[model samples]
Target: MEINTFRESNQFTYSWHAIGAGLLASFVGFASTFTLIVQALINAGATQQQAATGLMAVSIAMGLAGILLSFKYRMPVSVAWSTPGAALLLGLGVVKGGFSTTTGALIMAAFMLTLAGLWKPLSRAINKIPSGIANAMLAGIILNLCVAPVHALAAYPLYIAPVLIVWLIMLKIKRMLAIPAAAITTLAVIYFTAKVGNIHAGDIMPHFILVKPEFTFSGFISIAVPLFIVTMASQNIPGMAVLSVNGYKPDAAPLFTSTGVSSLFAAPFGGPAIGLAAITAAICAGEEAGADPGKRYWAGIVCGVAYLFYGLAAGAATRFISISPPVLIEAVAGLALMGALGNSLMNALSDKENRDATVITFLITIGGHAFFGIGGAFWGLVAGLAMTFFLRQRQLKAA
Candidate 1:
């Protein structure tokens, strides 16, 4: 897809569908998980203001990064907050040195990601990880979220059924619109069932609040290392897979470096972490975005613009989510991610040679256990690859 062709095609003829896809994907990605992010920040000892600032920073950073990458490469590249990283924070529940120290850890993670992008040996090592295991790790990370709708329906049948029904109908009629339909249905249910006025909107306006970094040995060991590992193994690897499956071949190092730079700037502002988006990027990269791949970059641009606006409203949005029942929001997010989870599982299991290893990775990750301050994702990769290596060696000996 040439830039000239993008320019010549009716001035890019702006595929509104592409733009819509981007907008929905971004909205779902943010709305569904922002409460968890806020909770993670607060649990890390951040004030509410600081948490909101973090959300704004990551939203803006990802938006701008997505736009720049899309325009520069003419690919539907999207960036996002690291969901797995946030989950890691949730599990940490206030590090030894508090929020400032955690911020330092985020900066360190960003620096490590930047190095991974710039250093050949590191990048090659990352690339050498079996795709099956990487995909499995991501799948395990998201599997819980994907099943939320069912749990929601079981618990709040009347409240959740309508949304689930809409999502299923949309999935049958128009696959790309399924999640959007579910989101709309969820909103409608909330409007009728819950008092709109009760929804909090504390300080609706967005404002920046910086939390200076305070590095510590504990922060680095517990927070920084795990964040970097989860971001790389769970987000970036699958993100690259999304692009590859969509028929775009991009150099991974630059993308990693760029997101690291964005995260570096965002860290001081309370952002947990940022990375290439795997699930939402798939939304923008798919056929629903557009028939012509050349023009698909417009989807990412529109998504970026949407994210910028979302950031501006982060304060209000976070407040509203805080007021809403957590289960409902998780259900919406789960619905949005079902497609992605299914795809990841398929990819993880597709390679027979790596099936055993991938399954090991998936089970360990889904187990959601941590040891020695390291998250399951890291351990999952280690276990899976070790099994894979051992099995390969055994096969060679037998042959």
Candidate 2:
């Protein structure tokens, strides 16, 4: 009888932990990237309904996949929409064919991701990139998010100050609850300030919207190729590192394969490109989840459930944002990404040999410069490699 009772107790505890971790992970994960998704959809020429569909599709797929994978692995494996891909989509899809272009690119990218997973040689090559360089790249990619809060403060000093104070207090006092505190404080400040100013409220419910996808050759060339490159280099590479750092040795093939499949499934629905999320995954894998590493799986599960809820209320979410101050979002996202950005920078510049190349990569990436219709990441990497090769050739000649 006592053994049975203990088993039941253990199950309950696991379930609860998973739920809590999932919720925290999902909130932070989505909060970190959802705006970028909206921007991408908008750039892709999606209608309001289509945009909502994209958000919902992404939320559902990420949530379900994250939950299933975490549960299967018995570890936290949180998935997220690919922010870098979304940024690429915005630049490429928005100006060209819009929704059609975006969908076409998504399909193509998914295929490429699948191929990458299957091609052992290519995967191995990718894995061979110096860990320090990869870390640096990841940190550089996230640096903008950390800086955004300062931008937010500049924009709305009156409204953001109170929330920032609350966030700092929570950080110092109740560290685990810092994110939730920032969110709540931001919302409160927005509401009261808006009410006092008599600003009209935005719509709070997501509309039921559907966008049928159409594929095109041009779309594949312009959008798909770039999206594929960025997702692989910027998202998946860093995501794997996060898991590794946490002592979870996940098989890379399944992880990449799952993301590809999920992206394919989500394309028609309205979600921005879905991929592995490095930053949020780190949070789930951290020591705070529990003493037992296995218990962290619950965090992924919780994040999935939250995604579902967010998807269902997409319309309402838009409405809430309409009256809400932009500073609130900026501050929260910036604060959330601070640790990630710091970690990435430290890793990127750790080795003296790689420092110059990594700095070049970071500048090119953050500079937003593109070449031949491709985005910054591809060019940044190219420039870095070119410099590295040149230096190596010089050394050989001297020898």
Candidate 3:
């Protein structure tokens, strides 16, 4: 009887841990990308309801896919809404279309992603990108995400100061829980200082607002293609690289295949593109989650469950954020990403041979310069690679 009781207790404990990890992972992942979606929706002239639906759709699809994939591989594989896609949506799609046009572009992008998945050779070839370049790309992408908090602090010094202090304290005292500490500190300050009515009552509750997709060749060429390229090059490639570097070795096909199928499933419901999340995946993969590689799967599971709750309560969730001060969100997000940004910079600049090239990539990416309708990340990589090749040729000739 005692043995039976112990077994049941142990089982419950394991389940609880898995659920906790999934929730944490989901919050981190969602926090990373949801802002871009909100901005995209507003830019696209989506009604509040439509925007909520889009957010929920992406969350649901990503959560379900992450859960399914992680369980299948018995490794934590987290799926996320594409931050790059959201940026593209904000930049291009918003100007061209409202909800209907954006949906059309989403469907088209998903279809293309699906086709890429089906072409196994192509997927494998893309996956063969050099680790240093892959890391440089990721560093370029996250550079701004980390600095946005400091920028936010300049905007709202009174509110963010306390939160920043608390964050630093947590970082010193409880390293694994630093993010949660910073988040808690920000929320607490907001709750105590901000008026209740200001925090809660202004925004309308988000609701389901479906926008049927309308196929447009022009929209596909301009919006969908660029969005897909950004999502794959900036998001998926690094996500796969993180997994590979860690030695878990989930099949690239299934990962991409799942993202494409899930995005298609989410299109009508207003989801943005779904893909593997490199930044959040790094968080889960780190020693903070667990030293054991197998145990890290729990982190992805935790993220999935949190995403499920966030998706189901998208209406309430959006309302909550709508009322909260933007400074709070910005500060918290910046603090959460700081560690990640530091790691990326360290890795990108570590090699003497790659230092110059990586610096060029970092500058172009961080400078936010766009050329020929292409974003910083894409152009930054091209410039860096070109410099790298040029320098290599020079060295070889001299030798």
Off by over 4 Å in 1: 1-48, 74-76, 84-102, 192-202, 212-230, 233-250, 278-296
Runs in model 3 deviating more than 4 A are: 1-16, 27-47, 83-109, 128-138, 188-206, 211-249, 267-270, 277-303, 324-328, 392-399
> Lowest lDDT 10-mer window, candidate 2?
1-10
Candidate 1 local distance difference test against the native = 0.80
Compared with the true structure, model 2 gives a TM-score of: 0.78
User: How does residue 158 of candidate 2 score in lDDT?
Assistant: 86
What does candidate 2's lDDT look like per residue over 1-399, in tens digits? 001011223543574554565677777766545655664576578865577677878888888888777767666787888776665555444644557656766777777777777776766776666655555545545566567678888888887788789878988996756766776676677667665353323343555465655777656655666566557766887788887887877788888888878887788666666678776787777775776565677787787788888887665444444466654565575676566567667777886787888888878766756565555655666667677778778889999
lDDT of 1 at 174: 74
Q: Which candidate gets the maximum lDDT versus the true structure?
A: 1
Candidate 1 lDDT over residue span 256-323, tens digit each: 99998999989989897888988789989889798877778888998998989989987876665555
- Tell me each candidate's TM-score: 0.81, 0.78, 0.74
